[model samples]
Target: MIDVLIVDDDKLVRKGLMSAMPWDSFGMRVIGEAANGEKALEFLKENHVDLLMTDVAMPVMSGIELIRIVRKRYPDMAIAVLTLHQDFEYIQEALRLGAVDYIAKVQLEKERFEEVLGRIHGLILNQRRKPPNEPASVDQDVYPLDTAYAVLGLGDHPLVNGPRQHSQGWRVEADGHILLWTPDLREELWTEVNSDREWLPPLPDQALDADWRLVRLRHIAGLTQFDLLQMVRNYRQRDFFYDCNGYETNPIEKSVQELQADQPEPSEREIEAVKEILHAFRWVHDSQSFEELCSQLRKLRLPASKLMQLLYGFIVDWSRLFKALAKTGITLPDTFLCWSEVVAWMGGFREVAATLSGHLQLSREVTVSIMSAVKIAHDELEFPLFAVDVAKRVNLSRSYFNQCFKAIVGYSFNEYLRRVRIDKAREYLAQTAKPIVWIAEHTGYADEKYFSRIFREQTGLLPSEYRNRHRQR
Candidate 1:
């Protein structure tokens, strides 16, 4: 796979790029990301990456400077720049400095971003086929791959900040993981590494040769720090993949007949498991419970495609369930459009479980009480309702209620009430011969003038004008 690194100061952009793209389908993956060029450079020092996608402007070190340095040190690596509309000059300079292409930040929609990434993937693959142009002398290199072995620290592990070496290889403690590298290149040595519980490798592509499982074997001839870092990044990413019996099963190679033939009707116990997870989600607020739910999900033995389908079905079911609970004119968030977007962001079933759990856990208080309070407000519009009255009905202090309401409903309590009142007013204006005053009073407005003012502010028309324009006749 073509491993990529994203460098940007904007977290939103980082997340968007991370979640929005079809990475695996394009034969690429985001091995790591950095907020600025300095961090990006540091990541590069530890990982072997095929491509670098960076923003034009950043805090620590600018992308142009990074590009110039990368071009000098890693001449074979492909580079891309993310530029703003006003950064045309910078883009030109980046291209001159050795960047392969540029993407306008403002226009980074899903289609365009994938298109650019796919192009870069093709370029990288092509470049890999060609031989490296670097001189074949160890003396020219700062840390030549042939002599001194590179050591990488695992993240937050007990062995971190320490170094050890056997006659066979060198090992360094990372934060929590231990990275080992050696020039031995023996098949048995790698097999032993693979057998270790602490080692997590990429999902094996069974379609390829079995020897392919040891990724280091293919790259050891010209191994750089990037290669070592890339291996660690690849290992970490396996956590995001859906595991079946503790291994990755490639779904793309399976035939349609095999997929359809293996599908079995879900058992009652499996159905109940789904229900129990959803039930727990409504009350689960802490990360511990959320993670527990994710852990339980890994035990499921369904195929990856089937598992994804089941998760999407659950999201749809939950959306309808949530809407029904609200019992009012509440519109669900726009996130309902594609469940695959959620799955794509997560890469596998466990991640899907965690994300769904987190989403369901939002604003537990708002969901339980405001749902009932919404029904009260909608059904009791003619009785005069206020934010405090709704809060009182829900047994919440007005300030806390307003906060939860806004957090869960995307609108303040007052805003929701006004919206409801105006919507009902419009319906009556279109369907009945009632006077504007009667309509206002029925929809909870005490004064006809005040209703007219708010109605115009919301719908851009006076009540009579709206009726004349939209009434059946």
Candidate 2:
């Protein structure tokens, strides 16, 4: 039987709740109770209850604080917040602290209470199957990925834009609706679509009778369930909201075969570096003052760009860690993603650390990405590093690197280099009217016609138009 604990300060309320739910029918056994957060902590110290349902406002410690402490220490405990509707502050805090359900007293009839209990039971069962310290051998129980459908317009979205990192969701066309899908949001949609029973299966290959149907998507990223959970949670705002534009169905599964196919998966060096970075925030006392910790990063032998990638990766991981906390009845502020904007927000590390957070934003993980453009730009318009060689150095497939480089830097390597060379040639042209052939050679363009074509495409005017426009401006 699943063990349980109900914590509240009121004696009558505690007894009433114990008698209200038929614990046996829901596969639960009430094991204990606590009148305050201190008492709850004591109970947790002694017992291994599968779940802990508690009142938010209590003596000695608030329910949110209790949840926070539990999330930090006993991350395994599931939590539910029992508070009045008037406790709006507590409700938000409770959700951040990992409260699985928030039920008001006035609406707590036996029928509704039973339903809440069942969902709590389902959620708890899900939590028991996950633990942070375990290794790969213990990872097979990852949550099953579900199919989800969503509709996002090309406008501001809370779920996508997040405070720090912008979302890279793709817009796909189906039924004439422009759809945007982020793997993170897709995971939430998948869980919701699976948990909600309103769905009725459609006839196979009948073009989907309804506006939506359940989809089974594969978690082809090759992340374990925990990693997948972290990926979604990291991108989401604690108080994040999204628009319901339209919907489409998606099915997902764990990408075990894809991972195996990676032929020597992720390197141990990369994995070790990421691990160190995640644990870094713990060492730094504050994130608000990052310059104070710049030396610390240098000590880790991490460059600034590499450190940034690690920070981004950890932001995603911390978000996932919060999910486990939510399952255990601990919720963090939805403003959690604000940690990512630290560098831009704070002028330097010293200023931020003096305030608090002491550069604790992402706990400082090491992820290195080469900043070749910035390096190559100053030397000449045509970089000595060929496009293929640059791609090989970054350890990306030729095609994949081409796509990633363009996405991150906003231009293809050769394309951008050509543009720069052409622009330089334009300078020489307007300044002294150099020969087109000389300009082409300087820009690394084998064909003068090709150089002119690319220059016109980029500037929306031919090389001549560009020279004339610059003179006019």
Please name the candidate that would achieve the greatest lDDT relative to the true structure. 1
Question: Candidate 1 lDDT, tens digit per residue, 1-473?
Answer: 77889999998888888888888877888999999989998999999988899998898899888998899889878897887642333355776566656676754655345555654565455456556774432211222222222222112122232322233343332221333444344435456444453443333122122211122322233443333333333232222223212222321122212222222334769756855664444323335545555555544533334455556665554443344323333232233112233333333423433343356564544555765565565678787778897898888999988876775656787787788788899999999999999999999989999999999999999999999998646
Angstrom error at residue 186, model 2: 9.2
Q: Could you tell me every candidate's TM-score relative to the true structure?
A: 0.32, 0.32
lDDT score, residue 26, model 1? 76
Poorest 10 consecutive residues of model 1 by lDDT? 204-213
Model 2 weakest lDDT span, ten residues long: 236-245
